[model samples]
Target: MELDDDSANGLLRSFGRQVQALRIRRGMSKAELGAELSYSQSQIGSIEIGRRVMQSDAIDRADAVLDAGGVLIAMKEQVERAGFPKFFRDARRYEAKAVELHVYATQAVPGLLQTADYMQGVIRMERPQPPAHVMEQHITSRLERQKLFDRDPAVSMSFVVEENLLRRTFGNLDMMREQWERLLELGRRHHIELQVMPTACAEHAGMDGPFTLMETDQGQRIAYVEVQRVSRLHTDRKHVRELELKYGIIRAQALSPSASL
Candidate 1:
């Protein structure tokens, strides 16, 4: 409930209110609008009260149905950003625009490479777990970030993931199998490289923990790290260089993409 008062929540609430107003002006009941939009009445209520975020296609449908004339369409970006945790919105922005990205993962799989079930399993691990709606928002935002994979001029990406992390059953064996399949599927992509770091290695450059290095098309370089739920984005050249060097060593230590796959 307290989360509904945050800046992100405020944006969602504002969007919801506008949708509600438009619906009312068109002489539509929640039930009727729900039918038209292919959502349940309760789902519409959840959206109208800002308890849920609607998908892009649904929003587009609602805009046309309500005669919003692009008003609702325009808020798409802001509403989408509201779906992520406050600490991560900035990091996702930089990651999305990266011309070249390298990741050294020690904990879970990087978000870009995760399956929906894996994301759900990871979300369940949070303390004082987020409400159901929050889970939807987080997952939605995560799936959105993966659009980076299809970007034209396709962003070059690589990840050095710890070997043992892949073996853990975050939820169940079935879910882990799906995730493994996903990894194998993505590894076949020409622009993405997946490496697995052996846990038996005596020395590891990334002992400091997981971090990512990103280089945007503009030539801007940055480093990102997160522990617990807190994250920092480093823009200072020296700090970025240290992480960059660590990633290079990590890639070397890990099995090559072909062997790892």
Candidate 2:
């Protein structure tokens, strides 16, 4: 099915088109596919039209029912990744392979460190409201990304968040407290270091805004910067080096990891 509005990201629309075509080729109607998957026909229709976020497991279910020989299942990662903003996709891919991750967060806790309730609060504050399903999918995908912390041959990770993030109440006082406790727990891991930039700092290097620097196992470095809705991943050697220097300074200016908690 050719989508009239191409506004949705290409990966999402492509996944939807592939699902619709495979179902049709197998002599299955939307209703039949829904019945097989235990979803309502309208839910199936919404998925086919790219109006609904496809849950991770739904891809496997579709693959089995349509007997697509793993074709649909192979697209699961890309489909789930489509839940995030377009600019963030490449960074997510790089993060998965990074040997070391350095982050400087100015406004809020980094996504990987955020608790579910905290994430929901952030999502609810978006200017234009996202549909409930979309919001849930975003939350699910974000949580899935946190699995990187537990992967074998764990990645070395460091974060320097502004002190205000801990004080900022996202959902409620309880939620903020929980988020702080989670950060404390994460900091206890040998592979992770958590620091806070004090509000009383006379000067800081991260005034340029938040950015992440990632070093791959092969020693290649990349830098990512996001502001407002625009984000970019920097691969240029000189640019990445500059970001690395700035991050080093920011880390030095932040509170010691042992003192942060």
Candidate 3:
């Protein structure tokens, strides 16, 4: 049977969720789990959420820890060349109808809030160094993606950003200031929410890195988790429930919305 984009995306999400469920069942902190597998914490988190491909060794370790009985073992090979980042393509499908979006970012400003120039600068900094024209194409694509926020009945969007991201100059001081201003402007929008997880938040989920929760029109929900150069989408019902619970705890621990600025 052929799968449409949505169907394919859903399948990937379900896989991601399953990985997360196993992680929790094993009661392993991301750091501890990554250490056991000789991967970074981000790598462990990414694998669990299906944002990054599972390394063979890591999968073996996970199986051992969770006593998976090879349930997750078979999936390792299938996701080795999963084509796209976990949530990258799937996010576009639901952005239009998303009733609510909760995002946490520790590295940089959220993509939707990024300007064309900022994106170009980022693209230029990639290790392989995309050609100027290619970089421009990426900039265009990213900026165009931001237009969804302009839709009527506007999607409810909230962002929790690490305080350190605010001080790092992404493009230039002017650009950085513009980014902050853009954030403030978006927060002023009736449908949007902006918060900051302060450096003094006593270590929370944001410390584990960044993730996103998106609610679709039919009320189905999913989590999108990202790591360096990769992303994952998780929609397994059981996994979604756990991440949602953790997200709630993190939200409560982070700085208040008004105080975040």
lDDT winner: 1
The whole-model lDDT of each prediction reads 0.87, 0.84, 0.68
Regions more than 4 Å wrong, model 2: 1-67
Model 2 gets an lDDT of 0.84
Superposed by TM-score, candidate 1 places the C-alpha of residue 142 at a distance from the truth, in angstroms, of: 1.2
Q: Which has the higher TM-score value, candidate number 1 or candidate number 2?
A: 1
Ten residues in a row with the worst lDDT in model 3?
78-87
What is the C-alpha local distance difference test score of candidate 3? 0.68
Supply the TM-score for candidate 2. 0.80
State, as a TM-score between 0 and 1, how close model 3 is to the true structure.
0.64
Q: Point out the worst 10-residue segment of candidate 1 by lDDT.
A: 1-10
| Residue pairs clashing, model 2 | none
Please provide TM-scores, in order, for all candidate models, with all chains considered together: 0.89, 0.80, 0.64
lDDT head-to-head 2 vs 3, winner: 2
Number of residue pairs clashing in candidate 2, backbone atoms closer than 3 angstroms, sequence gap of 3 or more or interchain: 0
The sequence of per-residue lDDT tens digits that candidate 1 reaches over residues 94-208 is 7767999988888898888999999999999999999999998888788888888888998999999998889878999999999999999999999999999999988788888
Worst 10 residues of 2 by lDDT: 1-10
- Residue 43 of model 2, lDDT score: 78
